[model samples]
Target: MKCFQLVRSVLDEIYSEIPLQDEAQKDKAIKDEILSLRSKYAKLLSSSRVIDYENPITRFSYIYSYVTSHANIVYNIIESSDMLCALMDSKKVSMTSIGGGPGSDLLGVIKYLTNASKSPTLRCNLYDRESAWGESWSDVDNKLENPFKISIYFQQFDVGEPSTWVRHVKYLSSDLFTMVYFMSEVFGNKTTAEPFFNNLFANAKKGALFLYADNNTPDFYNWFDELAHRNSLITIESTSKNFNVNYDEEKTDLGIYYDKFGFPKLTANIAYRICQKQ
Candidate 1:
């Protein structure tokens, strides 16, 4: 798997640098190619009867390390230590994660709090739809308890239907502590996301702190920022950083390995936005 991934990464780097009319054209072509590859892989995996589980490549330690390193980019850029310490000292925080991939974001925040103080107790209410990994939500919760050593509630909730889920989230988070971290799962598709955000803004209380990190794209950034401005939510900070591994120099193309159809390059910019509800 590592060999395949490395080869794929190299190929993707080469394909990405393939001459195009301009940057815009390059992005469009890559975007289209990514979609096409996704469809192709979906069919191939299904045919091979491995579609129900997380891709083997995604589970490799190196791949997760690469992902977590990117996640820390948001943590380093956002100055949440003081607020996290305050919340920990109080021993009460209503934190929720939307699309918390395998609970990495939740665990990262819990580690920050635990390391900052003396055995801080925290309340994390997680929300995520079923992930491709057959590892159910319970698996993530179990791993978190031993490391962070705190009380955590794991619940399967879909962010797209904020009406059904937001009320529960509000009830779970009814006091001086509120932090919401959401990721790519919600905003990747615009049509479904618009209503979800509308419901979220209406349901969320004032003074709530929100952190969203996702694959960067102009449309996602523009729409979310616009909504923040309209709702009086102050944008505390925003950051864009590349998460792609440089593979172009190897003169390879990973896309060709996917039975002629899987997205070869996993290049994505992890962009984060910190906001406070007014």
Candidate 2:
């Protein structure tokens, strides 16, 4: 089986661990379990794939391949809304991306922000624990040719660890608009997202806008919806687009499910939330 299939299998087993409740508790028991699972997943991804970066073309082929399928739709969705553009451009904004995956999503957000009239001084930060496993991972220094020179910082840390966040919070402070985007599956059995968000908003300024984006997989979709409803964070925008599936069809780690019928083999189903600290 391919790497992603292995991930999917692990996820299937772990999915049952997430609780279903209108008001779920962020307990030590939950946090520890998720953290343990995250470590296992990290090891699995790192060991299974040997990323070919010797050739520039070969390195970009996968990224380019995925982008050609998903980027346009994601761009269009982001561009069509004034509220989202505002959220991205809020002055004194401090955004932290979790599981951002080599910074493609930030690149997309920065592209939109640069095109708009508001040239806000943005201090962006990206967080990930996968850097030790692969050199291809993203950080603050990862650059793209752009008109907007947004200052971005990358911190390598695991989202599963509560202690790692002490430095993260100190770096971000409490007075900035904080946004955390999860492009990958960050809601598995081992994730510290709930506590982080709970603590983050408690210390945030009143106008802080937090956005979390994840695929519409059954586990994540349910998790995101529950968090949004419980937290009083209104859904400013929610939509789906034609996205690409990263794993090959023949690879068979996970089935196409509903995607098999569509002309575009992959689709990016995204959800956005704009919240006021109350």
- Name the best candidate (by TM-score): 1
Q: What is the lDDT of candidate 1?
A: 0.47
Residues 7-106, candidate 2: write the lDDT tens digits: 2333333233324342133223333433443354344322433233233232223232232223333344557777566665657555555554444445
Q: Write the per-residue lDDT of candidate 1 for residues 1-278, one digit (tens) a residue.
A: 12233334433434443466575664455455555434643343123222221333233222222323333433344335454344456655666665553444554564455345445455566555544322323333343334444545555555555555655645333222222223233444445556656555555667666776655666556777887777677776777767543332222333333443333334556566777666
The list of candidate 1 runs beyond 4 A from truth reads 1-67, 77-85, 131-149, 161-183, 242-268
Candidate 1 residue 122 Cα shift, in angstroms, is: 1.3
C-alpha lDDT of all candidate models, in order:
0.47, 0.45
How badly does each model clash, as a count of residue pairs?
A: 6, 6
Model 2, position 203: C-alpha lDDT score: 58
